[model samples]
Target: MSSSRAAVAGWALAACVYLLAQLHRTSLGVAGLLAEQRFGIDAGQLSLFVFLQIGVYAAMQIPTGVLVDRYGPRRVLVAAATIMGGAQLVFALVPLYPVALLARAALGFGDALTFVSVLRFAATHFSPRRYPVLVALTGMTGTVGNVAATLPLALLLRHVGWAPSFLGAGALSLVAGGAVALLLPDSTPPPRAVRTAAELRSGVLSIRGRVRRAWALPGTRLGFWTHFTSMSTGTALAVLWGTPYLVTAVGFSTAGAGAVLMVGVIAAAVVSPVLGWLIGERPSVRVPIGFGLSIVVVLGLVLLVTAFGDTPPAGPVVVFFVLAALGGPVSMAAFALARDYNHARSLGTASGVVNVGGFVATVLIALGIGWVLDLQGGTTARSLRWALLVAVAVQGFGVVRMIVWWLRVRATALHRQQRGEPVPVSVVRRRFDLRVTGPTGESGPGD
Candidate 1:
């Protein structure tokens, strides 16, 4: 198989595995009503349950980066997938609220490993020019997964019950784990045969040193902040909590809310790649700035309705979903910016930092929104409106972040060129010599 084909297959497998891993997190939104009735828990307690997952996942990201760097993605990912599956099984079988929360926390920690590992794999196997496209495509897979988690899971819950839905998700995760373990090739080589004992120690040290150096690069910081605060917060809130807010506050049914959330994701998945393509085709200030402006507009709409408008009105709900669709491309631009900034270094560090930032933002935002809900006397409509307002404000911060990044990129390019350094081209293609894998873990033939 060609390198391109192998990279494609490997990424497709990774995306599928990630989607399966994510089901536990997103499934809760649709299950909110059911869980409330069964457990007799109020909204605040239920929000805390989700918060437990986010907090665990956020805390685990930095270590996950180190694990990817030292242990290689193949081993780390297989372990994560297995743990994710086990947690889902526990979630399915457990009865008590505390036990379920424990299971959810376990699922959070397990699923935290997927994003960084997949990023490392993509950075190792694919060309630099192709990285953003692959990232966008992988992101789309996540949106698709969110859609499935909502509508399909809701439909499944309608007939089969939540326990069976979770059990089935666990089974799917196990199958995905096996496929990843078999199909994804390890990107690094084993220790050299002729090295002295001293040399062996130095080899391990050198690997750690490279990872450190990569983390310290200026580009890494620039990319990390851009994605973490602005891009990621929007995506997380929309996918994970969107349905619950819609149903609880807006009076939509479980299935109706699921369908609405699905539409939002489908719109985002469709729009993200187009923005990627536009950036690839033009590679200009206009594309990114316009992208940023578009998010501001969409988020502004969201903020307007949430802050000042009536929620039960059909006009506001219809407008909110349409605006929600516009957020996907903005996120795509942020991921692309990360790739563009990192240049020749380890994209894994950049990706990991961004992931860490985004999740941290999620924790802060989710908790803050919870507080706001309390302040609003705990009306579902008012609470949701407050959350939307918070999201819009956060997105405005993203717009500012992007503008700074653009200015920095421009200044750096000009400075380098004036100093007789090579002018960095918009599109760079770097070929790495790593054997790729398929869905079953067999190496691609002589790539």
Candidate 2:
């Protein structure tokens, strides 16, 4: 096949995998209540299940980065998807709660591979300028997947029973896995020689050393940090807990909450690509990102207001909250930024590093917030209220972080220019490299 055709196929497969991964993530939102009733569990148990799922998922990011870099995304991704699908199958069949929780953990571990693979693929195949757009488009597809998880998934789970739903979703995951294995092309140049484990470790460490050089620059480091902090909080709230908040605190039913949350995700889907476009065209991510973060801050305040029963009358308040829900572009912007800023030497590693902040946030802050709610008498109303306040405070910290970073970057650039020092510049460029090797110890022109 031609290189262009191969790249297209790879991207298509990645999209499918991403869609399924997203479905797996959001599926739990609807299943939470059912799982609770079926197992006679409470909020703490549910939180623990989610905590375990995300914690394992988050911890696997770096390992996935390493594996993808070594073996290429094709094999690694297929293995993960298959594992995830099998786990889902077990979840569908298992009767015991403990077994189901273990299944969820396995599913999450497998699902974590999806995004890292997508990041690796984008860095290898797509042009740098186009990477942001592609990443945003990928996120938008995930939002579509989120939408599927909401109304369609809820309806399916209710009508077909959760077991059948899991089986069907598992089938979809396996198909996605097979498709990816068949489609994705390995781009990294084959090893010059079969190196020892120590050699591999040395090489990886060398890459990290170079990565630290890039991170030493204030603009790049600050950008990465701000992106991580914001998305960490946003994803924890929006992806994991938004439905519950709507269902319990806002007085929406499960199905209703699902539908409403889908709309919010749709809003995010529409805005993300636009933000990426703006960043590419305008040459400043801060404007769009800053605007989005402002929305999050506003949403936080609104939640705080609502908690105090000082919200505006019903009609406008719902609209306001829905608009607040639209603040997800900030989260999307963070993903785009991660794709945008990193040097190309070890793209997967850089992305993994950038993503770590958010993973920590989700694990620590998201889980901690749940624990806090449990302490606040373990009721949804009280927990949500407290969680909102915490989200507000956390988001406020993110905003301040971004603002400070922006100012520092600007001040440094001005200082450099005034001193007649060569200022670092930002521009997106294309890169293509071969992956396979020939018999005579030479690289094949793969791309």
Candidate 3:
């Protein structure tokens, strides 16, 4: 196959691996009640499962990114698939709660590998112009897994029982691992010259400093807060608390809650391509677009908290969920921003750093909700409302951080332009007058 074909084939397999990762990540949401019954745990213990999983996932991000950069996606993705597959199977068969928690941690560690690797694959294989759409598509496809975790997994748990349903999911993951191992073509990194042993030791010692440098870049920091501000609310909802909140708090039936959560996932999936196209066409507006989306999300959260507090009627609640879901697509702009700001050598590291934002927020928000519920002594509508307020507060903080970073980056870009240095296309000033001529006395593309 041609290189382009090979890259496409490789990414297709990677996307499948990502699908399974998301499925494993969100599986607990639908299974919360079943988990509580089977493991004899309360809301706090149930939240611990996701908290531990996401914590491990968050902790593994930098290391996994380093591995992906050093080795490439094939090795990392294959290993991730195998570990997650095995972890899920163990989660299914194990009866002990402690053992189950270990399985979740393992799953989280494995899950961490899939997303950044898939992103690295896209970055390595595709043209820069194509990347925004590809990134959005990757996110959209992963939400299919989230949808599966909802109604389908719930139905399977109800009919086939927990062990068999999870065992089947695990088996599917193993098959996906095999496919990735066999079919995924690794990206070639720039060649490195042989170095002295002393030099190698010095390099190892400076790895932390190098990471710090990557974080210092304005674009990478922008990416981080972009992901931070845009993704956490929906992620916190979809991956752990949304279903329970709907059922236990808002009083939806199991199936009804699942359907509502499914709508949010589906809405995100549907909106992603449009956002991708818009970002591709007007890269300069990326931050503004993200800010707009964040505003919408904040509005939705405020409405949910103030208007729908305890007994939310379904229609307005669905609209609020859809608005929250739209944030996922908007967050894809962060990866594009990261790509523009960083070099290829550290792309994986930058991506890893950017990827951490949302999950970190999600972990804190999920755990906070659980803690609040525990303090309230049970899952009541009022307690759930209070828990959701935690999400609102966190999101509000993120929006402020995003705005601050965006201003800093924009100023830096302007300063660089003033010095006559080449900068990213997105930051260039556009001339609105169609008749305006460049120094060459001809209309430029910007005109």
Candidate 4:
């Protein structure tokens, strides 16, 4: 097979691993009521489950990145799939609440490895020009997993009971793992000179310095904040609370809520390619597009919160959900941004730093909503409405931070360009219609 074909096949298999990760992460949302019934947990305890899962996932990002850098994506992906499968199997069978909590924590640790590995693998194999679209496509594939978590998983839980349903989900992971082990191409890292034992130890001790350096890059910080502002609302809603809110607050039946969430996933999938193309063709618009989508998200939340006390009309509710779904695509620009700012060697670490932003926001918002709902004493429409206000507030804070960072980074890049230092082509803003000669003196589009 051609190298490009091999890369595509390997990436597809890796994306399958990501699909399962998404399913595992979001599966709890669909199973929330079932989990509460089985474990006899209240709102606070249920939120604890989500909190631990997301918290562990967030905590593991940097380590997972370092491991990927050291061991390569093939090993990391295979191990991730195995661990997630085992965790899900334990979650399916465990009778005690504590055991179930441990199972989710294990799942989170494994889930953390999939996305960055897949992204790192893509960065290794693909050209820089194609990275944005590839990232978006990878995200779009994961949305399918999210959709499956909704209707299909819900139906399985209804008919086969929770244990059988989750057992089947676990089995899928093992199958994906086996495929990755057998078929995924292991890319060899570029050769490095052998170092003395003392040198290796010094390198290990200086890991913090490396991370600090990556974090200092304006583009890296911009990517982090971009992810932070773009994905928090969607992640919080889709992964933990969207279904419950729709069912309890919007007056939809369980199936009705599942259908709506599924629609939102579909909407995200549809728009992802467009967003990717826009970013790829005109990198200058990356921040603007994310900023615009965030504004729409804030507006949607405002409208939803305002209409919450009275039953919200279905049209407005559906539109709000669709806007929420757009977050995933917009946040994906962060990966491209990270790629532009860092070298391939530190791409994993930079990506990890960028990845942390959304989930951290997600953890806070999900927990905050649960706390608010608990404070109000029930999951009624009024309580859920007030709880959703937390999302609006969090999103507003993110937008402000994003604007501040965007201006800072843009100015830094413009100044650096004025000084004649080479910057990544993607970071250099240019007109859409500008034509420039390449190094070979062939005229074409310019950044």
What TM-score, computed on C-alpha atoms, does each candidate reach? 0.82, 0.83, 0.91, 0.92
lDDT value for model 4: 0.83
Off by over 4 Å in 4: 1-3, 189-203, 308-310, 422-447
Q: Output the better candidate (1/2) by TM-score.
A: 2
Clashes of each: 4, 1, 0, 0
What's the lDDT for all of these models? Answer: 0.64, 0.65, 0.82, 0.83
- lDDT ranking from best candidate downward: 4, 3, 2, 1
Q: Which candidate leads the pack in lDDT? A: 4
Residue 8 lDDT, candidate 2, scale 0-100? 68
lDDT at 231, model 4: 91
Tens-digit lDDT track for model 1 on 15-38? 787777656667776777777666
In lDDT terms, how accurate is model 2? 0.65
Tell me which of candidates 2 and 4 scores higher on lDDT. 4
lDDT tens per residue, model 3, 252-333: 8888888888888899899888888888878877888888888888877777778765877878877777778777788888
TM-score of 3: 0.91
How close is each model in CA RMSD to the real structure? Answer: 8.5, 8.2, 5.2, 5.1
Lowest summed lDDT over 10 consecutive residues: which window, candidate 3?
438-447
